[model samples]
Each structure stands twice: as C-alpha cells, then as structure tokens.
Target: MRRAAKADDNQPVIVKSFRQLGWTVAHTHMIGRGFPDTVVSKQLPSGLKFTAVIEIKDGAKPKSSQALTPDEVVWREAWQGEYKIINSIEAVLEYHDWVMKKF
Candidate 1:
C-alpha cells in the first residue's frame, strides 16, 4: 500500500513566502504518487499570468532526506511542463525573478 504524503519541513514557509509575494499557492501534497507539492500562479507586470509546479525539500536536511522518491523521478521524467524543485527561500526568489523576466 502507498504511504501518506509528507510535506517537507520548509514547505509552509515557502508557501507563505510565495503568498506574501502576491502569488497564489495551492498545496498539492495530498495528491501523492510523485505529484509536485505545490502549484503557484502570479500575474506579471505585462499582465500575463503564469503557473508553475514545485517540489519542495528542506535545505537543512541531509541530501539523502531531500532526495526524490522513485515515483517522483518517474513523474518528473514523464511530465513535460514547467516544474521546479526548490529547497530554500533564495531559490524561490530566483524562480520568481526568472518567471518575471520571461514576460
């Protein structure tokens, strides 16, 4: 049987940070089966809204603890879309900056 989904220790902080930055965040951890943990959307200055999926890991944890599960690897490989793995608030800001530049 499949196990319950667990959010990384930093997930709440990341989600809150994203929301504070004016992005809409949806928690997707309950979806399980290697699906990303969150989906975030924001409207850029150019008035184009974009959505992206993210897998969150706690940067403070050991590398082994942060490693993706086999199902996650499979999901990532099979999915063809804008997906990112973020482990720190800095990475979140970087992603925001990158997305802002695309418009």
Candidate 2:
C-alpha cells in the first residue's frame, strides 16, 4: 500500500515566505505519485504571470535523506516545465530575487 505524503519540516515556513513575496501557492503534496509539493505563481513587472513546480526538502536533514525517490525521478524526467527542489528559507529568498531580476 502507498503511504500518505508528509510535508517536510520547513514546508510551512517556505510556503509562507512565498506568499509574503506575493506568489500564489498551491499545496500539492497530497497528490502523491511523485508530483511536486507546491505550485507557485507570480505576476511579473511585465504583467505576465508564470508558475513553477517546487519540491521542498528540509536543509537540516542529511543529504541522503533529501534525495528524491524513484518515483520523483521518473516524474521529473517526464516533466517539461519549470521545476526545482528547494531547501531552506535562504534558497527560497534567493530564488525569488532571481525571478524578480529576470522578469
């Protein structure tokens, strides 16, 4: 039997951070089947909005613990869109800044 999905320890904080930055976040962890944890979208200065799929992993965890599962690998390989595995608030902030600059 498949196990229930659990959010990483830092997931709530990360989702809050994204919201604070004006991004709309949709939690998708319960969707399972290797789907990413969240989908976040923001409107750029150019009036265009873009969305990205994010998989959250706690940075405090060991590297081995943070490794993606086999199902995740398969899903990622088949996905053809903006996707990232993010760990920590700093990384989230940095990514937001990068998006601000790029758009």
lDDT of 1: 0.92
Each candidate structure's TM-score, on Cα atoms with residue i matched to residue i, is 0.94, 0.96
What does the lDDT come to for candidate 2? Answer: 0.94
> lDDT of each prediction vs. the true structure?
0.92, 0.94
lDDT of 1 by residue, 33-89 (tens): 999999999988888889989999999999898999999999999988889999999
Off by over 4 Å in 2: none
Tens-digit per-residue lDDT, 1-103, candidate 2: 9899999999999999999999999999999999999999999988989899999999999999999989899999999998989998998999999889988
Tell me, by lDDT, which candidate is best: 2
Q: Provide the clash count, candidate 2.
A: 0
lDDT, candidate 2, residue 61? 95
Query: Highest TM-score among the candidates is held by which one?
Result: 2
